[model samples]
Target: MDSIFHEKQEGSLCAQHCLNNLLQGEYFTPVDLSSIAQQLDEEERIRMAEGGVGSEEYRTFLQQPSGNMDDSGFFSIQVISNALRVWGLELILFNKTKLSDGSGGFLH
Candidate 1:
């Protein structure tokens, strides 16, 4: 790469900036991430409804704010993961992996 790609932090869009920086390009926008967040929200809603639309838990869940994202541009980890999925990539937690030798190989 000729130069490092740096996307300045804008508002509470740290997740969006982090994702673009990881991909080393301007490959995502707030709109893109928001769309992903919305889709996730819908999926969660459907799952909650599976327990019965009139159930108290489902109604309570509907009243709660979206866990996937917020109006202030903050997005949950799930949103970021889903965004990366579009490029056929997966997000693995560094501290969650172990090598055959029983060491934290993912950190390396």
Candidate 2:
């Protein structure tokens, strides 16, 4: 059941809804989610082309990714966002690095 839910998440159907609802602006997009859900996705292409964030050994550990970026064997956005939406709250802290002007004014 968890796996199925995760699979749906990886497909990003939930993210689409979120975008339509809670997504304000800037970060997150349905296009971004869909790309990873399908094989030959742009993210995988970019990763391979750019020698992405992980080590070769880690890639090797994942059974070589089957050269298929679209397969959601474990993790995905649907699973992640669903979990987040169901039991999540946004947390942002006040920026402590405000600048102090010479006139005792602080800038955030």
Best by TM-score: 1
Model 1's lDDT to the true fold?
0.90
Report the Cα lDDT for residue 99, model 2: 39
Per-residue error at 19 for model 2, in Å? 1.1
Candidate 1 per-residue lDDT, tens place, 1-108, comes to 799999999899999999999999999998999899999999999999999999999999999999988999999998998999989998875665577766676633
Candidate 2 lDDT over residue span 1-108, tens digit each = 232112124452554445434444334445554444443334455566465438675465345543322333333544334334433543232445653454334422
TM-score of 1: 0.86
Misplaced by over 4 Å in model 2 are 1-12, 23-32, 36-108
Q: Estimate each model's TM-score.
A: 0.86, 0.25
TM-score for candidate 2: 0.25
Q: What is the C-alpha RMSD of each candidate to the true structure, in Å?
A: 3.4, 12.5
Pairs with backbone N, CA or C atoms under 3 Å apart (clashes), candidate 2: 9-78, 9-79
User: Which parts of model 1 have CA positions greater than 4 angstroms off?
Assistant: 96-108
